[model samples]
Target: MGEVTTSLQRPVTNTGRSKLVRHVDSFEIQPPAPPSHNGVPRSAWARARRRVSRWHRPYITLLLLLDFAAAAVASLIAIETFDQSRAGFYNAEQDPTWFHTVAFGLLPLGWLVSLWANRAYDRRYLGLGPDEYKRVIRAGVAVAATVSFLAFATKTDLSRYTVGTALLAALLLILLNRMLCRFVLHVVRRNISQAGHRMVLIGTLPECLEVYTAVTRNPAAGLMPVAIHVTDGYAAAKGIETPVPVYAGRDVLALVREVGGDTIAVCGSASSEPGELRRLAWQLEGSGVDLVVAPQLTDIAGPRVHIRPIEGLPLLHVEEPTLSGPALLAKNLMDRVAAGFGLLLLAPVFLFIAIAIRISDPGPVFFRQPRVGHEGRTFRVWKFRTMYVNAEDRLASLVDRNETDGMLFKMKEDPRVFPVGRFLRASSLDELPQLINVLKGEMSLVGPRPLPADDGDFLGDVRRRLLVRPGMTGLWQVSGRSDLSWDEAVRLDLYYVDNWSLAYDLSILWRTVGVVLARKGAY
Candidate 1:
């Protein structure tokens, strides 16, 4: 990712300044005539936008209805299960329908209100990231707090069982509903080309191409790059081929209109002018097109970034990574507790696996190898042996057959691995013994995957990964594992190191279950 140092006011250099100025001036002098529609509607793009708009509203409405239904059903089930007859402001004996009415109506309404207040239903959070889940959880807490406060204020004998059960069930149902909805949306976006925002990407050649690749790769994000408008005329003139149709940056609004693009994504260093983005926004004001600015910053999560407005300029402030203090302490505590619990609970499975390995081949059940750990420390990491005893000796002969690059070595079908080993590797069961490594505090349950002690002497930015304990599983494991390029794997590892949070760790752990089960990207 490119680092942004200069302000948005990065001056137009003299190299091609005059030629480009003349080129842009010519556009102002003689605007390209709009393509004659020959009586056809010019609102085709607008119609498509309206169609997408319609889709968004209906989907959100459906989510709302589902939430209401979930809350209502949860309330009903809780009250019925707990037999809260003598609860709430009015007792069931005094007014039989009073508690029922409140449970069925007020509880659901309050839940919806809490969700709305927390922006759980915001479009930005609808189908992606853990923010949606976080918001939902926050809404649940808000509802719980409200209930507790109301009960205390009114001196009502609210049934703890009923309230607790209702909130728990409602949150679960809502989260499940969101997951299903996201799955459906992903499928639709992947299969249907017209399902997402048709975007016109604006940037220099390299930046535009980078953003284009990212957008196209993640179909779940709903950003379809329809065209590219290069801000660097020299790069465009070099006849560099691009994935999307290229255009001059001077006529950006015209290009979007021609390409039916409903979104304009401005990638890194799109302009030399300080107010170019603001001007672009002004140009898009009445066009019903979204303007998105992609900063050079990458891999930094939202929680670490903040925008501070002074006068008319908005400055981006990034907080330093939380490498120490209460958060890391909490993470340490969580890792030890979870690792201890997992070891005890999975002892029988571990024993079974050891027996299988013994039967499959004559070698040690556990493979312990020296790995780089926190602060450049070396530790013996443990894993179930998934290769023959002579695997290391055969490595020299198979060096040319390595499928992956960089300090790592991988092969889809290594001759050294036994049949049972293949199964264990694919299912990631071989790594189960690393619970011991985690328990010993040599590794975390989530962080950068430790490299072999001889991978290479860590240097420069790569050395940052050693600041935290290596992990049994991490962002790289959940993302692509062996399928990822060496550089990409390193980048993911660095991202994990830089932006680690307990929530992020938990999310990775949750996704790791799915990734392992699906055997995606596993050797």
Candidate 2:
């Protein structure tokens, strides 16, 4: 729900919940008529949504710490705060018959064992969306339940204090860790997008148009699609309403030479003769543009697609994503750690920002906007108020000042910003409150920035950005900020998703410092 519109303008949220968004359905873009023997058929965009990492590590770590801390505190209170004999005992000591002193001291070990035994690390639903969080919560509950059932079944002496304390500690820890990871990733992505890498989307008329829309939607991807060109069914350079110009140059070789695209997406099948295709290859032989051809393989995945050179013709193999064993373990480990830390560090930041906002504005410092989070569920996103208390009442009058490229609004000098609000925005202090969002698990520190709930008129076929949590800072934040046009922003975001890596996060964070200090895109 937070974003940068353009230069000379700073557009903040000032609309009421009554304003609804224009949502688009995924109307599968179809290909040209039955493929003539003369040209290749249509292509499918099998792009995978980006999986945030690096930041996830802290989320995991924080969770572990919280769980341990909670257990320790609970044990102390149980052993001293309350009489141990009063609560039903479910003793876990084995043949060793450890003494009370050690048994009370052994809370940490018991808590660890319980955490592992319940498979809190096992994530049956990781990226399928909301189910992932649900699965983890269920697992936590199951672990606690198992311990309780075991204690009762055995009729052994057990400390109810120990079990409750351990469970509460683990839950709090995991949430804290997740929060930390979100911030790390956010900081990291900003750094990555600052690296100088632009993108050029190549495809058929329709496909290239879609690509243009993608590049305009997310700028944190670091790959700015400076220009979009169609490879077929068009003869001249055309504009596609993207932030960048759209050129429909049919000659691949000529386009490659003139436009000099860095990363080329062969969006759909082209009508070039084999000889033209060869010439295009020769022209691009040493040029660094990554020529990615998305063939007519719908429902295909990267794992299923392998490259093998048969003589000179490149072929691809496809495979299905398996859901089991190591994949599950790796995913679980990733989830727990990410969710854990995110909760801890953000806890304090959230407090400070909330207080700051309250000091400046009489209205609630935290403005909660219901946004579509993972899996289309609505979640309230947290942000600091930077506008007049009655800003929403004045939106209709300001609509004319809206410089909209697509679904976004750009107002160089908005009337709604209060005096202190400008500094908060320039320093990005306004976004500090979103750390609460990271804690809610509704957003990430780094990812595509979210869109306003009801502002989806011109976005057209570019709705995929909603597939993931909106980021606090992303490819666009470091690329050019408000200086970037809509096309450039989306290109960078799409590119980030296509070529995401842990290193990219590190890179984005470094660049973010430069952007902030220079105030390149800040208001």
Best TM-score among the predictions, by candidate number: 1
lDDT of candidate 1 over 54-74, digit per residue (tens): 456788889889999999889
What local lDDT does model 2 show for residue 431? 78
Cα deviation of 330 in candidate 2 (Å)?
Answer: 6.4
Candidate 2 residue lDDT tens string, 1-523: 1121111112123353233222223111222222223423233633222122222244445555665665556555555544555333534233324535334445455555555555443322211123334444665676577667776798767656655665665556554554454445445446664332355566665666565554444443334455555554233332224455555423343344455445566655652346655544444544444455545554333444688889987767654433235643443344346646755766786677667767777887766776665545567777678887988899889888886464566576777877677777787877766766765567766666766666533253345465555667778788877777787677676655444344455467667877787778676
lDDT of 1: 0.81
Candidate 1: list runs displaced more than 4 Å: 1-54, 87-89, 93-101, 141-160, 191-194, 234-238
Give the Å error, residue 479, model 2. Answer: 2.7
In terms of lDDT, the poorest run of 10 residues in model 1 is 2-11
